[model samples]
Target: MSGTAGHGTVKGRDFRLFWFGETVSLLGNGIAVVALPFVAVLTLHAGTFVVGLLTSVAYLPWLLLGLPAGAWVDRLPRRPVMLVSDAVSFVAFVSVPIAACAHVLTIPHLLAAAFICGCASVFFTTAQRAYLPTLLSDAELLSGNARLQGSESTAEVIGPGLAGMLVQAFGAVAGLLANALSFLVSWISLRAIRVTEPPPSPPPEVRRRRLRTEVRDGLRFLFRDRILRTLAVFSAVSNIALTGMSSIEVAFLVRTVGAGEAVVGAVLTLCGLGGVLGVLVSHQVSRRYGSARAVVICLCGAAPFTLLFPLTGPGAGLAFFVVGGVGVGAGVVAANIITDTFRQRYCPPDLIGRVSASAAVISFGAIAVGGLLGGVLGELSGVRETMWMMTGMYTLATVALVCSPIRKLRDFPESDESLRAAEAEKAVP
Candidate 1:
């Protein structure tokens, strides 16, 4: 037997439906990466600032809604939350084509739609993360996460290119129809899944139902101990650096290195390939180096590569670009695993929504700042100089290992046994 009882490749009917639905939706989201910005800049004639607003607005819900939404996810039936969120996503996406056809699609309306969809995404994401461990057992988590990583990486490798081709052929408006359809598909799959989720625990009295208690409990759960706090802070900083780099990477490639779109795409595709490869090998790497130490070394190795990105010449950029890709693909898996472990072990089982919301908000908030600051620094100095600056920023991100014992440690949590220990400590008033 793998993890949960009744195991096969399909993992039973519910897992199959749940997995396929998310895979479909993620692929479509991959399409949105290319489509959303295209529509914002080309179709809507937005300026740089408007584009920034669109991107940042898409993230704001994580800041404002993550905790409350997570609490709500814990309180409600996870499947219904998943279904309704998908439906909301579908409706939000459908309006894009309708407005485009009417020639009534403005940047503000487009942003509005994106904001709505993004908010729903926060909800659906919280529920899905919470929903997963219940469906599998301890032994199967490795293989199950591998499947997820592979699916996500596969989507990354192919989705953007496909989106670009689709937009070029069909126009961005029509391409978004694919995203809308993906959401509808996900909704139907959710409807088919059979799981007996427990109802909320508390009575609907004013005291336990208050927003403050919910938010406070979530925060405490997310940061109550050494492990969770270290994981959260490190992950947040690393993601910020990644986002900051993205904001400026294209400009650097174009102006500093004189690279074309073809080169940029090719280099990123290589990184995506690295991600696919990384997921395949993550378990082995965790075993060999110990998960936390492996992640630490990966982060340290990647920091210096940031400098290589800015150094111009024919071969220099290519070498650094490839190195960065490998680092990123592997690093992403490391971060995902660490954070997921923290959530799974430390958070109250019933409070996945709120704790995840806290994590999401912190992570995404850093991303917004990183993107903004990257753009600002690039404008103030030069792109290459800005890239060099990030080398130090990223190095500082790794400094958390020094603050937390995870840096010196060399072990995975023995099992979900650690999860129980963490929970007992938390039950202490």
Candidate 2:
């Protein structure tokens, strides 16, 4: 275990396999991010509100299934849960291209596909987060997370550009096929891993508890911790604004900015480029500035740049979107690396799934709300106006972090034990 868990080394075959598969899958997901909305706009001729509704539908499963899925994942073998999720998502996405080929692809069909894929994502994402700690020791977590996030960011760069070419040549629906095949690769890689995951060991009493009780306990654990609670609040608020802007981003570029499909892909690629740069610097920043401080710097510094997004125009004005997106992307990605590493190390292994799900439910639920709100506002006011509102809200959301106890700490507590020890010391005085 120590050999595999060494910092700055990627010697573990199991982790390598896992990383490869996820990187491939992430690339496909990047393609879908552009392709899915383009299909709605170009193929189905959906309006901005309807497109936003589609985005909301994709994330709705997280709000609906997040809590129970967390409890269920805790009770089951996590790898198997992830495998099943991959299978389900593959089937859901693959159907889209088939429907298009048959001239039977409707907006409802697209919605159903998005909803199904979202449901699978709720399970897969929760299980994947919990499973990572099993592969790497606490010392290796930051390195591992940075590697994974770096790959994801890189995929974000390559995938959109590739999707644009594919869409330009084959059609919007073709990108879904690439996504579906990536799922198959992920499934195979997971199947090949030989790591023997220890069975989940809830206390005998916990094993006998009702599922609802287990979920409540998870939520309780998260909210009871001041740092975690603060992080959750910040995530929820940030996601609402970010998702609102992203839900209509494709439409905004195509219709409002007058960017062609190829140009849209190029602009989106800048976001991934920023993410890669953030990943490269995250470890250094955390080491130099303290994890807590790094997070504050990222969020606070990035917030104002989002204002440039709504100011985008045709030729020279596009640079505003580019610079603003790169800033936001770098900030968000670097901050996420620190926070995710903290959660994995700090939370108890048994409660990881549930805690992660609880956190995600709040943030992702906000995403759903953002999507709907963006759509309604886009329809009522305008796409550009909605962008302004969302970006401004994103800038304001940082106040939640500024007001929290996080602002006072230099570094986050390492574990529940560290937090309790600190409290005990305070009480001794």
Which candidate has the top score in lDDT? 2
**Cα-based lDDT for every prediction:** 0.70, 0.91
For each candidate in turn, the TM-score is: 0.86, 0.98
State the lDDT of candidate 2 residue by residue for 90-163, as single tens digits. 99999999999999999999999999999999999999999987788777889989999998899888888988
Q: 284-346, model 1: which lDDT tens digit per residue?
A: 667788876766666665566556555645545476766776666666765465446535644
Residue 298, candidate 2: alpha-carbon lDDT: 88
Assess the local accuracy of residue 132 in candidate 1 as a C-alpha lDDT between 0 and 100.
Answer: 75
Candidate 1: the clashing residue pairs are 4-137, 70-353, 70-354
